[model samples]
Target: MADKVVVFDFGGVLIDWNPDYLYRQLITDDTERRRFLTEVCSLDWITQQDGGQPIAKGTAELVARFPEHESLIRAFYERWHEMIRGVLEEGVALVDKLEAAGVPLFGLTNWSDETFPWAWERFSVLRRFRDVVVSGRVKLAKPDPAIYAEMYSRIQQQVPGVAPQDIVFIDDNVKNTRAASALGWHGVHHTSAGATEVQLRELGLAFA
Candidate 1:
């Protein structure tokens, strides 16, 4: 088995973050909450922030469009910390196991530059990565070919002459993983820690 460089997606793979965590406190009605999340503050809208749009600009535009949900929209960022419950312990354990085995670890995440700092300060596990390529910081997001190319380039900066095939990227979103696979990198669609561990083990990554 070849020595592989491991790249991890932070959100679902390592950190437990969800807008619902914040919405639940703001919007009590399940149906109404679902409607607001899907229609007003949708994932598509949030992805803009994740792709480098300023949080204030995004929020202001959203509030303008949905004047009725002004308070809710404002609270999205003001109360952003509530959205992140904590690190996914199992996933962090994988990082620890890999680190213990001397595996080279890197991070690729589609997170807002404005909000990522909070996570960086809160989650010590995030600091373990040798290098982290943040989408918002780089003005690129996943599922976009450009972002994957950017990640490849960044990895090359650290590991000169490293082929894309020598990298294994783990992402919770299948679309993102598929994008990585298209770039000749081994992509693991992480559903759960146990399942991800199994796949990594098969690829010559040993974790105890």
Candidate 2:
């Protein structure tokens, strides 16, 4: 049997990325902040960026639609790095354990091509991954089987003899995890670092 490899999702799984953290600072009124996030810079809108839309174009389109909220929309990408609070220490520690145990690490994340640089610059833990498939760069996102297949292929290429079934994918979204499971990869629906550590242990991955 080929050795098992661990695949991780970046956003909620390893990093604490919340737009509200940045939006709350920009828009003082809680109600108005919520409104802006919901009606203007929504998750759906951001997903487009993740799907390879340039931040410049996305912000411009949103500004054209909601002209009055232009500045707010511009701030979305301009100050995007501020949205990421930091790496989840527990998650990082788990990764560290996996690394120490000689397990190969890889990342698969639905992040904007333009804004990913900010994260790439801020977080050193991301560098630990042997390879990372970014949605924006590849123009594919999670819950889409293509991206998962791409990740599997990339891993296979990097780690010779590894098969799809030998990979364990960890993601915060159940849909993404399910999609991975459908692809024959072991899926871990990450709730907490401790829980994930338990799951990895169950899989026979030694972590001290």
RMSD in order of candidates: 1.2, 1.8
Give the TM-score of each candidate.
Answer: 0.95, 0.91
Error of 1 at 156 (Å): 1.5
Per-residue CA lDDT of model 2 for 19-117, tens digit only, reads 889988899999999999999999889989998988888888999999999888999888888888899998999899999989999999999988788
lDDT of 1 at 65: 99
Clashing pairs in 1: none
TM-score of 2: 0.91
Off by over 4 Å in 2: none
For 69-148, candidate 1 gives per-residue lDDT tens digits of 99999999999889988999999999989999988899999999999998999899999988898989999899898988
Where does candidate 2 clash, by residue pair? none
For all candidates, the clash counts are 0, 0
* Candidate 1 Cα errors over 4 Å, as ranges: none
Using lDDT as the measure, the top candidate is 1
